[model samples]
Target: MIAWFRQHGRALAAAVAKVRAQPMTSALSALVIGIALALPAGGYALLSNLSGIAQRTSIEPQLSLFMSTEAKAAETEALGKRLRADPRLAAVRFVPRNEALAALRRTGALAEVFAALEHNPLPDAFVLRPRDAAPDALDALAGEYRRLPGIAHAQIDSDWARRLAALIRLARSGIFLLGALLGIGLVAVTFNTIRMQILTQREEIEVAKLLGATDGFIRRPFFYLGVVQGLAGSVVALSIVSLSLAVLDRAVQSLAATYDASFQLSHLAPADAAAVAALAGFLGWLGACLSVSIYLRQIEPS
Candidate 1:
């Protein structure tokens, strides 16, 4: 095990030295890989943040069942029970006229306005959350609620939620497609890079073969080189994405504060970062394996 570790360590060092020997080319190639990776990675990060914002900002459409002003408290309770029993509803909350008025009074600006009223004019109401948030389901439930005997108004406040959900879904599909394309591009980039390295060291490879070195031994340095390049690119991509998110977070926070909102941007999670690094390394290793298999076959002991 120690001997194996020593051999691998020497190959890793040799790979580093080769990259150091052509600093400009290596840096340029890694930069290209990083940019290609950053596009999709950055998109994924933005989409995740957008999804979080949408979830926080998008208010669930609630069915407000305002009863007729003459309706009694017993009637409201009966209706509330029926609404709760329905399979379509997740919850039903009854708000008495007095309670609703008190809630309005809690708002500092509206407290004095509500206090000036001669009497409590607000009607008893029921706020409902549906089990299914789909637009069609909400519309159907709203119609049913409106037809109830004492229900003076049944309003569904969900148009924005529906539109936002659809937009997020469409955006997610687009991001997925973009990521797939960029992933293929990354693999191709690594493949071409490895191919060039193989060509450059063709004579050395032949000499190694003549010295009784196995193909595995000859391929070790290139594998290390590819993996190192991939990891380096991943680091660059992560840096660019994090900096962008930081800048955007500041802007988002400033805008949110203007509306008295407590919104904050989310950063990439640790698991996601790990996945990105693993993906890059795996793709690099795959590209190197493909190139090595092709070129090594062509360079025999002859």
Candidate 2:
């Protein structure tokens, strides 16, 4: 037990000392990893904000049900009542043809034309609010409403809403894929760096082998070296991510205040922050292992 403890103590001390000796180089490498990680994390934040907007728009979605020109007011009122009574309905608004025509005139641009018209050409319409009006739910409800006996046509109020939601989803996926590619770059960078370090120590490794050191004994230090690099890189990455978010949040909040919005943009939730750190560290560690394993085998210096 004493021998094992002494050997491990020496190895750890050496690895740590090596890092301390090259503070500038180590710091630069960590900063590089941090920058790479921050790009993806920022992209993800943009996606989250867009998603929130899309969700807010989807709430209380309504289907517009227009009646035929000859449809009676009683028929429209009855339809409104029936819609309100349905379990799937939230609220129903009835617009008479004359009231709809008046609304058009109030928009000001159509005032002259609306005055010239002899009859109210606008049809009676029902504005429907559904209980669950997410894109898919609204679509299904619109399909059912279009088939109703008295309804001339049922139209989804926000056709563009669904498209926006789809676009946001696509953007989010793209960001995630981009993050993955950047992570690969990080691993590549770390691996190359470790491989170079191993080659630099070839003479010392050969001397140890001549002294009857086993493969495990030589390999253990390189493994420890990888862990150090990975941990350092993670610390750097985390700092970058946090600092970038802090800067961005201030900018976003400033813009939001102009619009009188109660917007407080969120950062990476706890789970996501942990995931970012863990992923960065794991990649760093894996990169070191790959580099060390390949070169360690190439050096049969004994």
Candidate 3:
């Protein structure tokens, strides 16, 4: 175990040395990988922020059951109890006609119009939050409630939520497609970088082979090099994302203030950032393994 550790340490040191030897090349390669990764990662961050805003803004699909004006208080209470008992509903809150009317009166714009009315035109209502936010499920629940006794109307103001959900899905698909293409490009970049390194050290590799060095020994440093480059690139990518979010959040904050809303873009969580780094490292390792396997065989000692 000690020997294994020592060998790995030596290989890692050598990889670091090589990268330092060609600072400009390594930095440029890392920059390329960072930019590619940032595109998809930024999109993901944007989607996450939007989803957060939806949740914070209470975009949950809600069904409002307006009771018939003729419905007695007893009947309204019974309907509220029935709705509360339903397992599919997350919550059910009853709003009495009087309370609804008072709320309307409190609103500056509607107070004048409502004050002139002789009788309260507003009906008793139960605001329902369904456990399932799926469009079909919401529609089904709304249809079911509409048929209930004393329910004059079952209105769902979930069209905006549905549209937002659809848009998020489409955006996720686009991000995935973009990430996949960029991932392939990253692999190609590493492959070419490793190929060039192998070509540059052809004579050295042949000498090591003649000295009876095992393939694993010759491959170790290159593998470490690839992993290092990938990790560095991920650092660059995260930095770019952080900086961009900071800039965008300022503008978003100013815009949100106009509407008297509090919102800010969230940074990637620790787990998510770690996953990105792991994925980048794997891509780099894969590219290095492929390049070394193919080119190393061609340079066998004569």
Per-model root-mean-square deviation over C-alphas: 4.0, 6.0, 4.5
Cα lDDT tens digits for candidate 1, 1-302: 99899989998998899899988878877787788888878888988877776786647778889999988778888898898889888888888899999998886656888999999999999889998987788889999889988899988866776677778889889888987887778778878998998889888888888888888788888888888888877888888888888998899889877655666667778998888888887777777778888888776535
Q: Clashing pairs in model 3?
A: none
lDDT of 3: 0.88
CA lDDT of each prediction against the hidden true structure: 0.83, 0.78, 0.88
lDDT of 3 by residue, 1-302 (tens): 99999999999999999999999999998999899889888889899888775665567789999999999888888888888899999999888899999998987666889999999999999999999988889999999999988989998876787678779889989999999999999888888998899889888988898899889988999898888888888989989998999999999999877755667888988887888899889888888888898877787655
Which tens-of-lDDT digit does each residue in 120-225 have in candidate 2?
Answer: 8888898888888677888898888878767788888776887898798888889989999998988887888777777778889878888988776776666666
Superposed Cα deviation of residue 26, candidate 2 (Å) = 1.0
Best by lDDT: 3
Against the true structure, what is each candidate's TM-score?
Answer: 0.79, 0.71, 0.77
Q: Which stretches of candidate 3 lie over 4 Å from their true place?
A: 56-61, 65-93, 96-154, 300-302
C-alpha lDDT of residue 36 in model 2: 83
Model 1 gets an lDDT of: 0.83
- What's the CA error at residue 2 for candidate 3, in Å? 3.4
Identify the runs in model 1 with alpha carbons over 4 angstroms from their true place.
51-62, 67-90, 96-124, 130-138, 149-152, 157-170, 300-302
